[model samples]
Target: MANRLKRTSEGFISYRFAAIVIAALFFASLAGWIAQELVPPDFVERKAFYGESWRPGLARAVDLLRLHDPFHSLWYRFVLAFFFAVLVACNVSRFRRIALRSLRAELPAGAEELRKRPLSFDLSWRSLAAGPRGDADPLVRYGELHGRREAVDPAALEGFFARVSALLKRRGLRVVSDRADGVIRFTASSGRLRSPGTMLLHAGIVVITIGGLIGSLFGWRGMVYLKAGETAPLPPDSAAVLRVDEFRIVTGHGGAIRSYVSTVTILGTRGETLAAGSIEVNRPLGYKGVNIHQSSYTMGEGEFARASVSYRLRGETGRRTVELRGTASAVLGDGAAVVTALRFLPDFRMGPEGAFSASPFPANPALEVEVSAAGGAQRGWLFLRHPDFNARFAAGIDLALDGVEPVYYTGLELSSNPGAPVLMAGFAAATIGLIFMYFCNPRVIRGIATREGLIAAGVESRWKASFELEFAGIREAIRREFDESG
Candidate 1:
């Protein structure tokens, strides 16, 4: 039973299993994003978009697989959990290997073992004395005496090993030497933290996965539509109310819309305002851990639309402002004339029979009004953009359309995620780990120095070409040191 358990655990933590889990996560996330885009948020709209051909089959598939909201689905969460487990197991296994390699202090068994390494060389004193011969490098191989064991004086061997150890120490490598059976074995290493740095990177990935799971399980996302001067209850079980005080559309040159802003207020249960602020694209308003983002807007006639009209009587020196909504009447100049708003047209147009609106968008807004006085009544249009046209209807009173209240519903997306900070911390940790792993090149050099000459080998974690040059430089330095001493 213990052996079976061991086999299962080993398989679960294997690199092949980790790769399969990673692939599953990537494809799952991709499919989720595609489904989110193809399916509408509203159920009716999603059904309509699916059309008649996909009525039962595709619809059932989408619902059964939870494609519309895959991130929150049970199967996706299970996959994420599996992926996290794989990462944790793999990190543990890797850390064990790194610890073993870091703690081990044994040198290569013999010259043959050293020669099998990626970088290795054998040198003898006879060839060094002969000097460079026919392009044969003494630092790499001792010319014709390469790999040949030759006698060396004990005192000379001791001096040579001492100089090499000092050189390794000067180059920031930790050196350890052992003497057994007249053979001097030494090992030197630098940048021992490289493996731990790689382990840190994997641990950071595991942390990121944990954070994502927390967000998926506990977080909430919803949307709400609120018109100007309107209030609605917040979604996802919040008792707070979200109110839109005003909405403004900023236009740039050529009358193109630059941005839209919503002045919003969050009200407590007692109708007390908790927070008030403006929200624009990419900017969100936060209240009680809920973030409200301005997602979109729709234009149409609003139930509470109001028109601001300014009027002056024939004998009055100043004008008075009055608000009108949907055929509401207001007195002008102490009841000298009763002004009634008959119709309002946003993006006005003069039809053959009457005045009408070209579009719901407020461009060239105009208001039609009826003025009643002792001399009878007159009806005319007051243009908000072109106030000069008001003079045509100045029979008893001069009137101008100052402005009109916006009739737009601001769409706000509300979300709350407690794991965002954790995710950010994970990313920062991963970045630091990557920097350490790439820049801190770990290297190890082992050598056996004896009366029969020297055998050396080296290995580096990465950047083999650069390490080769560095190793060659070290060999040359050793050779130079010996020649100078002689």
Candidate 2:
């Protein structure tokens, strides 16, 4: 053991790498926090809008957390990497020590080494069954109100010497052959003699950590929404294409809006169909490694009344301004998909007795539209629920349904976390191991016997108040066995 300890002192066991790594992490975290505070933000406010910015009514949002990206920061990664390294090194350092201390190790050649450890017992078995029965003194019967019990009662120890010796010999109780020794040594530690629970806990942590590393290396996560008729691309690792066939919001029994359901079709990268599923609030669509969430829906209807145009065709291009209600004719030539502010609904609603009326969420939707150019009062009052709302407007041109804007699902978030499996496995293993270690029950007996009239002795049990209960139980069992046997 001295030599082993000496050898272990060479590397991690003595060098204290864990302490060093922890200190490094402490400093690194501090430095990162300071740097984050000291450095001026590398950001431009009110910058020109890019393809990622700008919305209908809201202004473009400024990106803040992106600057110096704390999570992706170099210092943060260095600290985490160093900490993980220390954990692995610590485990490796202890692995050798753990292997050397196995339960299969043989008992020492001399009990002297064990004797110095506060373990001693002077027990004799003789006072059983009024006398010894050749080599079977303890193996006798006792009186039972129902049936006799054939148990070893040691109260007959005095007359059962020869039989006791034989029993001990059969049990492999070896008396030492050392220098004039007649004392016998019995080593029996109840409950758990070998405690390896801590080692198992350490190993469980290692597995969980390694699993976390695997998940971090290979896990892919992203979110997408499929509005009606729209196709969305999967993440970099996905092989499927998702299309939202139809999305609708259905309220509860009393129109409480229980949830919004979306019918989605999963298409392979090569345009082949793979799967179809419906997703709703709280219920997400999962396929392979991707998850599609039913985020939101919107519906608005208006006519193709007035159209905004590039003045370039009208011999004016740079002169752009907000088109006021009723008199704005910046038209595009040759009639492409015309861009026009057909009409606007501040408070829109759709249901029975629902329309763009004066009442809030109007009972009847109205279209105040104007033609784009050189034409009569031919416009569109495209009803959201009813596609035939085209006829409800000023007539001339047949109002054909070019396209109706659907509702948008907002704040839809998605991501895949593989760490869940690892965490769950670790928790389960620890719970089961602990239960096995502490819950198993054990029983033991002790007695003394004499010739004339033997006296009952004691017993013991684990997992409760042991001493008194064990003695009482042994006395009763002895009395009952004697009564029944006679």
Candidate 3:
């Protein structure tokens, strides 16, 4: 009844609640699949973060599941939380039983339970050389037990059974009968039950991984896109900052992008530079518990940019703005300077729609730069890049436009969470549990007999063929002894 109660509880937990959690995970995966199939094309705009497009339909899905970062979603957290809870409960319940067993100083033998087990049996056989003395001979049992029925004699089978019986008794089983009919039985057990701990040890790993899943839900991953020649501070704890010093993209023969490289300085909390590295796809920079990689590339040129620092005073509102692109002509109240679009590339696309909208490469690389002193237009088209690269303004105000070096860089992904490790451990535990309980249950044998010349075989459980093989060897030894005596 105790075993039945335990079994019923496990059944309810495993098939009812556990099954439901598993089903929910299954449904979640199915929904994710459907989302993958339908949501992408319907979305018209692309978000640089998480690579999702800005579309009417995806906003709700993305926000609710945190699809911007799905693995860090609530659904995953809910399932993993339940899984960990189940594991904790299972460990507690199982250990409670182990605690009880441990309290006993040692395993006690219920002699009655050991004897009169269901598989008890008996057999009878007559000797070829018959006499009451045949029974009196001490070698009589040994000879018949010797078990080489075709070689020594049937008598050896009896002796072989006796030796095997003694070996079993030493192992703490009570022998019920040993006879010459090639049959033997004994009852045995070991705290060998303690060997079951292999299950717990293996399950521990999955528990750790489940813990990792929980961490991720509470965790966050943010990206820092650093362009060459520029820097931006990262978001707090949920953010990490890095500066891209140099960026390069190696392309295939036909200009298909093959690989990219970005040299950057990684920053930890408080805007501190933690490490400097050259990052790429397979090669990521790990520092401060985050990984940064060169995930993308873009085209832009950095030249000796000549720009006037123009700013409207603190209280000057309403269109009183000072914006600098390259060098531009501007009258700052009473001052004047030159404004030239320096180191101009042909095409630059930015925001939903903005300037530099043409092809950013050399196809139409032309800069229409204007230089005005004291609020007037003195503008001209400058072919700044060339096989010759020589383009300048008329009559020395001295603005030397130098070589335009391209700026290449990428976005770095930073993430940290504690849940992944726990989920992994739980997965490992369940695997080990099944293997130990199913693959290694020991066999309990009990022996008895109804006749003098025959042994009986009995067991509480069927074992692997090992039992049959051992029994056959014993029978052969007995037959050999009997044949020799005859």
Candidate 4:
């Protein structure tokens, strides 16, 4: 039973089955590529796969399949896994066969097969005496001219063939010779290792697929917002904490935002500092396996630090500006009135339940102040937009809201892809395999000895046009040697 199961596994992993699997994978990848191109980059965060934007049924299907994150989808991973398995099986099966073929000293071919090759040509005594002629030369030159030429020198022809053998050897070709009944046969081949170039190419792809599998299984990406002077814990799997030391924005001459920078500090699990640096729009910080990029920033008054206000009295000659925060009180005129800042709100609004703050944004800013003087004490809100709001208070003193400083928070995008190294190695290997397959092309040339002369045939279909030129050169060389032998 175990043997049967093993045989079944091997059968399923055979080249025929593997080709089918590879074709299916190609279509699957094509479908995934098309689907991904239609979706926005942040489809998951923006919740784009829902509601009226997308039809209900299509949205449900996309959501169920996690099509937004196509790279990590179950079907994508399964296809990669299957393709990798097929590549491994195919390489294993072909490797031994290729190795054995390369080891053979001679490869016999049928006469019909040799004649069918495009590079095949029959040479006879009369043809050899006619000198070298290009295939495009006029056919009248081959008529029965029967011109008298010096008898061929056997020693020079032997020397020429020996020279040809040496040239093929210099070019890394294995030359094999066989002689029978006064007929000499020869075969020359180069780039034997490249005989399995196809298998190597597929093996490189398998490595790349394995890399993708690693990334899909172990990689992660997300974005986090950190206010100035705030520390946010990293993901549970990550053993570091990210602190936003400062968020600075550089403005141009016209107050246009030129650039934004975030000073970040990385801390270990026990609060020990590990690394600290600044990250800008195009620049990112790397700590351990996590990459932190300054993605965006928000302006708000969540942690109000200070507020400025103008203070004056009924008989005051000049107005004085007071900076209020944390128990700062100002006396109006001759201490007749007092004003204290209880708290600061960058954006102050009334909630549904009459609460003070409606949101964290500083869209509508207001300051809550306490006033006490002479006969009564009153409390009210001072708004940035309303300058004359202090006139409503008749407590013998007036206060005007000037401006409030807002806190800026920086958003960081964090990503950890553990498979990046494997992917890079796979890419390098794939490039090498491609160079071997195409650049160092392997070719086979077979020569069968006949009573009249030598019949040469070459396997040149892989690169027909290029091989045609190469065959022309070889033919010229043979003709030069044989003609010189005369």
Candidate 5:
């Protein structure tokens, strides 16, 4: 029963289980992107684009699944949570094994165990005395005496163990030795932090997952539009106010829009400035944990529009121009008549009820004006594209909308995530862990040193081919030392 339970526990935390959970999370995220980003929100728009055949059923399914906000949906969150749990379990299980292996020193009990190692060699006084025959090839020389055991000189055995320890120490390994049952054992290692570095990488991933959960649960995002000097309250229960100080559309050489820039200020509830800066495309302003980005811009409406009106006395060829901003009034032609600009509309249209703007784009600009004279007051709409429509409004005055320049309002997207700093810290930790794990080489060498012979084995965490050559060098050096001692 205990063995069954252990097997079940191991299977639950295995890499296969973790990979399955990761795949589920990936599909969930993909579904979220398709629903929220690719699909239109309006049912009519969706029907128009995707065809009306499958619209109703698809829309109903999307709504039922809450696919419009999948990241925040219960099912998506559940999947993510499950993945996180699996990752934590796997990391914990692996970490225990790695820690035990890396922190403690263990040696083979006897010659049989040492011989089973991939890079193992046995040397005796007789083998060292024989040495290499011709070119002194380390690989060939070690291969010749790998498993042979012969009687050894006690003094020579002591000298050989001491010399091997010194050589490993010079190569930056921490060496430890033990003596038991008429045999001396030695273990040496380098890059002890490599295992811990791997664990740090796993820990960083766990931290990043936690940070993402925090952000997904508590963060908020919204958009606000503000003209110059206009202020709007920040969204999602924030007491701060976001004010647009200025907005400009930077144009390139051919009069194409290069970028949209907005100079803005963040004010506290008490109207004190909390932060202030300029934000353009790809540049965002950060205040506390909130980020404000310049998203878009549109032609301003109402009081933000400036209009130029040209007027003349009836049947007169000469005309006079008066500048009018919003509903401000200006006298025309020797102050005989007053013209008040009541409203301005971009993309103007007349509906069943009255005049209105179809859209914010300046496709068909129009200006509403009220002309007052000694006879009476007449109100009329002057179309900038068609001056003839304004002819019959007043008896003795001619009015025309000569030109209209639009002021632009900046569109800004604001988002706040309390876990952003934590996420950044996780990324930094993961980067350091990667550098340590990849750039540093960790290796271990173990051997049984006895009066009869020596059996040594070495292994590297990576680059097995290179470490094999290094191990051969160590064997050759030991052979040379014994030869000199002789």
Candidate 6:
């Protein structure tokens, strides 16, 4: 009675309300996560800080809604927490009833109930009476007792019951028997472990939810760029430091970068080594709860030890290379002309304000050169791509620009999340549960023996087709035994 009441309550919670709530929470969380991605935290902060007049009101609304960081938002977290509770409650209620019923040692239904089962059949001694000649045939019973075979011969009943019991065991059924008042009952079951499979599955979902919560609340991700041999402290408030031992880039046949490799060292605040390893694209290094990945690189202005430019006169036989540095003057080979290196830009760009480098990549190298000779001092832009900036110097000499050397810096992306292990365990548990639920189907069979004959059958498993085939084979074996006994 207690189990029945538990089932009734479980059905009410599971079907009437639990599923809908969980589904709603799941879709809500999903939508919030997508919205968070659309409104990036960095972009929102940039717009808000600059007070950009063109900013979309929707972006501000998203920030106000905390959709910029949805997973960590109060409402989303509450949804996860509530869904977790629902799963636990549903699992506990359903597991108790299913476990008790599946592990039952006795058959709960009577012969009439068994006859009404979907995958059940009957075997009657009256059928044996209708032989080839329609003659009264000798009856048989599989029995370990004599009292129940009052109308039929005891020996015949014993033989039939014995054969059937052995057959049930051979079919991998764990059998239990009871006898009283000239009647015998037998119950058998298969794949008993399946009862707990679904419970474990639910537990897995709860674990995964907890993991996600942990990650949302505590995990962090950031990028750090460092030059080779440079040691930099980790994020503010972190007691660790990262040292770049080396950085390398491998190029493929087409000069495309095939991989980015960084040999990095992790150290304590006191400069003691904690860990050292190499990281490549897709291959991250883990130390002290943090993962470092090779993300990108840059070449910034003034990163080079020296800057230089080469030039050739309009009718000169060879090009002259003159090394350049900050505010340096170099006299031309010709006594009539002079060149002054006023400024250098690794990646040159011109703006209304002034000259500057657009980025670290030295795509268009440039030098600000001032030439003074017998005529007067003239300033011009000498570009590596367009070298003929001041071709018509006062001294009738032309100058062509050359390349500028660059220094590179490596970018490493670091992330830390405390919930990874819990998430992994949850996924494993869920997979095991599914395997048990689908492959380890539970099957139960029951039988009653009388002086007249024996009636035995069972229900098909969830895999209905396979269960039907196995049941058919069991029936065939029973027929063979009956025919042979006759």
lDDT of each: 0.79, 0.47, 0.51, 0.72, 0.80, 0.73
Residue 214 shift from truth in candidate 5, angstroms: 2.0
Model 6, range 260-327, lDDT digits (tens) per residue?
Answer: 88999888978899899999988999876788889898865644535566666657878787776556
lDDT of 1 by residue, 1-486 (tens): 999999999999887888899999999888888988986676445665574557667776777777777888888888877888889889888888877776776676877788788798776655544345523654435434355545777888798788889988998888888888888988888877777678778888877877886787888988877778889887666588899998888999999889889999888899998889999998898877788999987656423278888987787798899888767788877778888887767777878986667776777777788988888888988888998876455466788889887567888889988778778888887777788778777888989987866788995547688789888988887776665334
Task: Identify the runs in model 1 with alpha carbons over 4 angstroms from their true place.
Answer: 1-5, 32-51, 54-56, 70-75, 100-106, 133-158, 166-182, 221-337, 340-402, 405-416, 484-486
lDDT of 5 by residue, 200-246 (tens): 78778888988887897899888888889999987666788899999
**Best to worst by TM-score, what's the order?**
6, 5, 1, 4, 3, 2
Considering TM-score, which of the candidate structures 2 and 6 is the better prediction for this target?
Answer: 6
lDDT of 2 by residue, 1-486 (tens): 998876665544444766787788788777667656643354234334431354532322223332234545655676787677666666677766655743333223343343333222212222234333412433332232223433333344322434443443443332121111322222222333223444455556666766777767867665554446778776655666677787666777877778777887889978888999888888887776556666554333332223222222243334332232333432334552233445644234545874553332323444434444444445544433444554432222223223323243322345565675786786666555455445533233222222322222222245345545544553444443443224
Clashing pairs in 6: 141-156, 141-157, 141-160, 142-157, 142-160, 142-161, 143-157, 143-158
User: TM-scores of the models, in the given order?
Assistant: 0.68, 0.45, 0.48, 0.63, 0.72, 0.72
Model 1 Cα RMSD, Å?
6.3
Q: For model 4, how does the per-residue alpha-carbon lDDT over 437-473 read when each residue is reduced to its tens digit?
A: 7776667788765444556787733677777887777
TM-score of 4: 0.63
lDDT score of residue 105 within candidate 3: 27
Q: lDDT-based ranking, best first?
A: 5, 1, 6, 4, 3, 2
What is the TM-score of candidate 3? 0.48
Range of the 10 consecutive residues with the lowest summed lDDT in candidate 2: 175-184
| Residue-by-residue lDDT tens digits, candidate 3, 376-418 | 5455444433323333434222332233444444666766555
Instruction: Say what the RMSD of model 2 is.
Output: 14.5
User: How high is the lDDT of residue 322 in model 5?
Assistant: 88
